[model samples]
Target: AWCCGAGGGVKSAFPDLALWTAGQRVDEALSTGATVLSSACPFCKRNLSDGAGNRNVRVTDIVELVAQAMSGRRMGLT
Candidate 1:
């Protein structure tokens, strides 16, 4: 339940800080051994995906998850 760190103009005004914050949140998610991190916000998905660069985590939107589920596609680490 942590922020993806793309809020309050922090991403545009301070890219590095935003990335760092997003990375922290990603790390927290990784700690739980989660392979996918779903967000309701597009900005969060972008920031979190950027933060997850080179990692085994997949950052995606809830809508996409639903679409995949509805389509009967398996969602996993790729």
Candidate 2:
């Protein structure tokens, strides 16, 4: 699970703060090598998705992902 960063307006008010926070979260997630990074909020989704960079990780809303997963339609599956 990714921590909340944009709650304090870190991404919009301070980019470096946002990058640092997102990078830290991404590193933690990457350490697990999880294919999907799920979150509840839209800002967290944006931050995590952007922080994922070139990795195979994909960010998504938990509910949306769950619906897709239940339907057997994975998000970002092309």
Instruction: Name the candidate that leads on lDDT.
Output: 1
TM-score of each: 0.93, 0.80
Q: Rate the local accuracy (lDDT) of all candidates.
A: 0.92, 0.78
Off by over 4 Å in 1: none
Candidate 2 stretches with Cα past 4 Å from truth are: 1-4, 74-78
Report the lDDT of model 2 for residue 63: 93
Could you tell me which residue pairs clash in candidate 1? Answer: none
Model 1, CA-based lDDT: 0.92
lDDT by residue (1-78, candidate 1, tens digit) is 777789988899999999999999999999989899999998999999999999999999999899999999989986
Q: Write model 2 residue lDDT over 5-78, tens digit each, in one string.
A: 66677888987777678768877877886678789889998887777788777778989888998999857734
- Candidate closest to the true structure, highest TM-score: 1
RMSD in angstroms, all models? 0.9, 2.1
